[model samples]
Target: MTAAEGQSGTTGAREDERPALLRMRAITKTFPGVRALENVDLDVRPGEIHAVCGENGAGKSTLMKVVSGVHPHGSYEGEMLFDGEPVAFRDIRASERRGVVIIHQELALVPYLSLAENIFLGNENSHRGVISWNETMRRAGELLRRVGLPDPPRTRVADIGVGRQQLVEIAKALSKHVRLLVLDEPTAALNDEDSRNLLELIKQLRDEGITCILISHKLNEIRRVADRVTVLRDGRTIETLTVRENPGDEPQLSEERIIRGMVGRDLDQRFPSRSRYEGADAGELALRVTGWTVRHPIDQQRRVVEDASLTVRRGEIVGLAGLMGAGRTELAMSLFGRSYGRYEAGSVHVSGEEVTTRTVTDAVSHGIAYVTEDRKTYGLNLIDSINRNVSLPSLSSLARRGVVDAHAERRVAERFRASMNIKAPTVAEHVGRLSGGNQQKVVLSKWIHADPQILILDEPTRGIDVGAKFEIYTVIDQLAARGKAVLFISSELPELLGMCDRIYTMAAGRVTGEIDRADATQESLMRRMTVDRS
Candidate 1:
C-alpha cells in the first residue's frame, strides 16, 4: 500500500480502544519486494507492559518500526494516535521528541566509546555543539543507576560482556525521557540470570508509569512481565489476551495455548526430532579441537573461549549448552575457520591430522560447515535469490573456470530445497522475501550443499514456531543418521538433553563440566554454570 492509502486505512482503528493512551489503526507497510505489515491494529494503556508475540517473521518488528517513525509518517499506511491525538512521526528523532524510544536486539552501541558517550552519542545535550563531558557523565551514571546497573559511566562498552552491554542500552533509553518504549527481542540473547535482571528492569519501568511495547520470541518472559499480550501472525492481529486476568486461577500459560493462538491450530510437536543420536564408539573423529584458548579482541586480557577441547565423531551428535555468551557461538565460529576473533592458541584436527585454520577457505577445505545464530546478518545473503544463497558455500565446485555454473547451482539448490523443505515461491525467489523459518531452512540447505563431514549449528530453532522447530530437529537427526558428525549449540537445556548423545558446559571461557544424555538434568547444568560465580 502507498502512504496515501495507508492514511485512508487508519480510520476506525482507534475508536474501540479509546480512553486508551495510544491507539494504532490499520497499520500496513510494504518493502521493495515484501508486504511486511497488513491492516494491523494495536492499543496501549499508560502503565502496562503490552507484549507483541509472534514467530520471527510474524510482522512484529515491521509493525514496531512503522509506529516508531523508522518507516516515517508518509511511508506506511496507518494512523497513530498518541494521548488521544493523531500524530505523524517524520523520523526517529521526531518520535523521540514525543518521548518514544526503541532499543533493538542488536544494540546500537559504539564499542570503542565509554557508556556516557554512547548514552548521548547523536542526541547530545549541548549548546551550539559545544559539549559538556562532566555533565553527560553525571547524567549517564544516574541513568545507569536507575536501571540498577550501579556502574561507573566511564566504563567502555567493549570492556563489559553482552549482558552488561544490554544494561547500557536500557540506560540509553531511559536517558531520552521516554514515555513509550519499544524493545525487540530484548532478552533473546541473554542467559537466565541476565534475563531475569532485564525483566525486572522492565517491570520497574512499568511501575514508573512508562508505556512499554515489548516484541519478543520468548513467551516465558512475556508471561512474567506483561499484564496484557498481543499475538500477531501473517501480518495481522491475533486477538489480544489479558494473560494475568485469564490465567489468574492458573499458574502459567501453557505452550499449547500460545501455539494455538499463534498458528490458529493445535501443534503436537514442540521440539520435534525424528530420531535420537546413537552411534558406535569406535567411529573416527571427523573434527577435533584441542587446548583451544581464544581471547577477546578488544579486552585481550579477558578470554571468551577458554582452554576448551571437544570432538565430533563420525555419525554422532554433540551438544554444547551454556547461558547466552558462555562461548557457545565462539567455539563454533572459531573452530569453523576462526571467523570470530583474534586467536591466542588452538589446534584443529580433521581426520586425525592437525591443520591450520587461518582463513575461511582453509576451514572449508577441511570438511567443516558452520550455520551462524544470526541468520539475517551472517548466515545468508538476504538480497540474493534462494538458489544463490544455497549455492554460495559450494559455488567453486559448481563452477566451470571461475564462472558460476547456473544450471548446476539450480540443481543443487533445488535438491536441498526439497530435502530441507524450504518454503518459497521458486528457487529464483530472493531470500529476503521468505519468512524467518523458511529463511533459516535455506541456511540449512546452504550448509548441507557444502557436504561437510561435520556440521555445527548455533541456535538453530530460535524464534521459530513449534511446528518448524520439529522440522529442523529432524534434519539434524538425519545428518547424524547419514554418518555425518553434528555439533549442536542451544540455550534450551531440554533440547540438548533430548537430542544429544553427550553435552558439554562452558563458563568464563572454559569447559567447566560435561554430562551424558542419560545422566544430565537442568539442575546439573545450572550448578555447573554457577560453580565459579563467586
Candidate 2:
C-alpha cells in the first residue's frame, strides 16, 4: 500500500473498522518441560508502529520468530494471516520472499564484509548468473540514505560503531523490500543519541507505509515510538493499548501502566531502597588504585589509561560512568591483575597493603574479582552447567586433596542460585540455555563465591529487563551492606545516579570529574563524560 492509501484507509476510523495487516491467532508454543506461549493473539494494523513489551522470558522473541518463520510452519500451533491471506512459511527465506523481515538483536551481518556486500549478502543483484557490483552499490547507497546513515557503501562493518551497524541492519531489511519489519531489542546496546536516531528512522519507515513490530524492554522507548503496544506476561497476552485510543481525557497509555502489565504489580519505585554513603565518614578504605598507566597491547605508542587513580571504600558503591570506549573496562581489567592492556605502571592497594597481582590467579588470591562486561565470552563457560560455572572459581574451597567434592560443589551452587534468585530448573542446567538475566546471576555467583572483598562489576545489568535489574541492584546493596567494596561501571547515567555513593566520569582515558550522589545530575555527568579531549 502507498502512504496515501494507508493514511486514508485507516485514518480516524473506529477500532473495529481499521484493518489488521497482520494477525496471529491462538498461538501456542512449547519447549521441553516449558509452555513458552499459550494461546496468545495479536493484531497489528498497516503502517503503524506496533510494540511488544514484556519481561525477559515472556515469549516476545518466540512470537516474532514464529511470525518470521524461524520456527517454521507446522513447528508450533498457530495461524498467521498477512494482508487478509493465510500464509505459512517453511523458513526465514520463504518469509523474506513475501516481504516479512526480522532483524535480530545480535546483528547477522558479517563483520569482515563491506556495507554493500553485507546488505545484499544472500540476495545479491545479478544478471544471467553474473553479480552486478554497480547495481548493488547503487541500491545499497539508496537504502543507507533512506536509513539516514552517512557511511559509504565501501565502508567495512568491523570499522564502524554499533549504532551505525544497526542502521546497516535496517538498510539490509529495506533491500529485501520489507513490507513488515520486525526489530528485536533494536536499541538495547545503543547509546542515547543512537537510540534516538534509530527511533526516528523507524518513524520515517512508518510514514513511508511500512509496518513495524518493535520488541523492546525499555518502556520509555516504546512509549516514544509506538502507536500501539501489546503487553505480554508469562507467555500470555495481557493487553493491547493504543497510544491515542481514548481521544482526550487523558493519555491512552503510560509507562506505569505498561510496567504493571509486565510485572503483574505496581512497581511504585523503579529502584529498590538503599542507603547512600557519606563522604569522609563512609567507611575504611577497601581497594585503591594509584598512579595507574596502561599502554595499548598492540599499539605500543598509544596509551589506553594514564595515571588513573580511584578507590572503593568498604560498605560503599563507587560508580565509573563514561561513554562507549572511554576506557572504563580497560581500567577495571587492568587493575584486576593487568588482564587487559599492557601495564605500563600502577599500584593496587587492598586494605592499606600494596598488592602485586600479575595474573588472574594472583588477583583472585588477593581478594579481588571482576565480573566482565562480555559475560558470554569472558565470564561464563557456556558449554558447562550452571553449577560448574558457579563453582569453578571457588573449587579449591570445595576440594580435598586436589579432587573436587561433587556434593560440596552442588551445595554451594544451589545456595547461590537460591540466594541470587536465579530462575532455572536446576543448578545442573547448562548456562547457555538460561535467560540473559539468569546467566548474569550465575556470573555474579561465581565471583561472589570466590569470597572477593573487592568486586568490580562492569555493565552488570546490561541486557536484562527492569525486574531483573532491580534484583541485581538488591544484590549489590546487600554486598555493600556486608562491607564488600563494589566498583560499578556502566554506560547508563541514571543507574549510576540511583545506586552509587559517588560518581567518577571518564573521557578519553582520563577522569574528568567526580561528584557525590547528592551533587550528581545527568547534565553534570554528561558534561564530564563528553569533555573535549583534543
Candidate 3:
C-alpha cells in the first residue's frame, strides 16, 4: 500500500483514547545560572506521531534529553514512566535497552565509517565474541531498504548527501529495535523533497506501531503529519492541541494558533514590512560578478559553478534561490575568497572597480563578508566567549600598538549584544550555551563588526524558530536601510519572496533566471531552479 493510504487507514481512531506509551510529569532541569526547564509535562501514545512545538530556548531539547537519558536520572527532578512502569535511565544505553532511541539534530554517525558499520556500531550482530560480516551486511541491506535508501551497505557515510544520511540515522535507530523514536529537528537541514520523504517515513513507522516524538520549528510540517502537538514556551507547557481531525474533515489546528502558543503573542506579520525601502531609487552598484566559473576543489575537472553572473546594488536585499545541490552555496563560497572550489574564470567589481578576492583577508579587505551555512563548523568558536567571537573578524580594529585592546573588544561586544538583542546574560557567556537563534546573532555580529559593504548570508535562519526568524529579518532590513548590499541565500521560497527585492535562481551550476520580487512566485522560481543546464 502507498504511504498516504497507510496513513489514512491508521487514522480511524483518536490516538488520545489510547493509553500513554510514555509520560513525564513536573520535569525540572537546571544548569549553572540557567533554568532550562520547569514543570514541563509531555505524553505520547503508541502508534502516533507526537510533535513538540517551541521557539528556541523553550526547553524542547532539554525535555527530550531528560527522557532519552542524555541528562540522566539523577541530573534532574522529574517523574517519568514508560509502558506503565516508572523508570530511571542512567544513560543512553539504558534507555536504548528499553527500546527508546533518540536522534539528535547533529547526526552522530562517523563520517569515515561505512553505512553498515555506522548502523551497527554499538549494537553489532555477533556471536562467540566474533562479528559475522555476511550477516551484518544482509541485515544492514534489509534495514536500508526499509528506510528507502538504495545505496550499498559498504558505501561510506561521507559519500552520501544529508537527506540519505538522515535515512541512515533512522535505520540505525531501527537496528536497536526502537519502540519510541525521538527526532529533534529532523528536517531542519533538508530540502523540500527530502523533507516530505522523511515525514512519510515517520508516518509509515506510525502505521507499523512505532511511536515518534517530533521536535521541529516547521509548523507546516507539524500540521501535515502530527496527530497532536504539545507547545512549550519559556520552559513550561503551554497547551496540547489535536492536529489530526476526523477523516475528510478540516484541520483542527492552524499555524497561527501554534505560533500564538509558542511566542505567547499573536504574530500578525511573520516577515516585517520593508515598505520604507520599496520604490526607492536604486543605489550605487556595490558588487558585480561576470562570467564566474569554478571547478570542484578535489576533482579539479568537474565544474561546480559555470558561467554564473549576478549583481547587487547598495541598500538592496537580493536573494539566491535553488535546490540542495544546485550550486548556490558553491557560488557564494567560491566568491568569498575562492574558499570552496578552484576559480577558473571570474571578474569581481566593488563599486564598479575591478578587484581580486584570492584569500579571505582579500575578501574582507574589499568590504566583503560571508556568513557560512554551517555555523557550528565555520562561523563561530563554541568554546569561546560571545565577546571574543563577536570581535574575531575585526580584531585589527580593536588592537592598539600591535596589542589587542580588551576594553575596546568588550565595548564592541556589548554594543552588539544590546543592539542585536542577544539573550545571553553577559558577553562573558560561552556561545555554545546560547540557543540556535542567539548563536546566529553572534555570527551576524562578528561580520557586521567588520564593516563590510557587501554581505552574503547563507541559510542564516536555517534552524531558528519563527520568532527568531522575524528578529533576523528585522536585522537584515536594518542592514539594508544602512545602505549595505545584502545577498540572501535560503532554501525557503516564501522567505526569499518576503525579504528580497529581487531573486536569482540557479540550477546545475548555472544561473537560470532572475525575477523581480513583484513577479516572483514559488512556482515560477521552482521552474527555473529545476532547469538543469548541465
RMSD of 2: 4.9
lDDT for each candidate structure: 0.79, 0.85, 0.88
Instruction: Pick the winner on TM-score between candidates 1 and 2.
Output: 2
Candidate 2 global CA lDDT score: 0.85
TM-score of each: 0.88, 0.89, 0.93
Residue runs of model 3 more than 4 Å from their true location after superposition: 1-17, 148-151, 161-163, 246-250, 275-282
Give one digit per residue, the lDDT tens place, for model 2 in 145-176. 88778889999997665657888998998888
- Tens digits of per-residue lDDT for model 3, 94-116: 99999999998767889899999
Error of 1 at 415 (Å): 4.6
Error of 1 at 519 (Å): 1.3
Poorest stretch of ten by lDDT in candidate 2: 1-10
- Find the candidate with the highest TM-score and give its number: 3
Candidate that beats the other on TM-score, 1 or 3, i.e. the better one: 3
CA deviation > 4 Å runs, candidate 2: 1-13, 109-116, 125-167, 245-251, 275-282, 295-302
lDDT of 1 by residue, 201-222 (tens): 8888888889899987676777
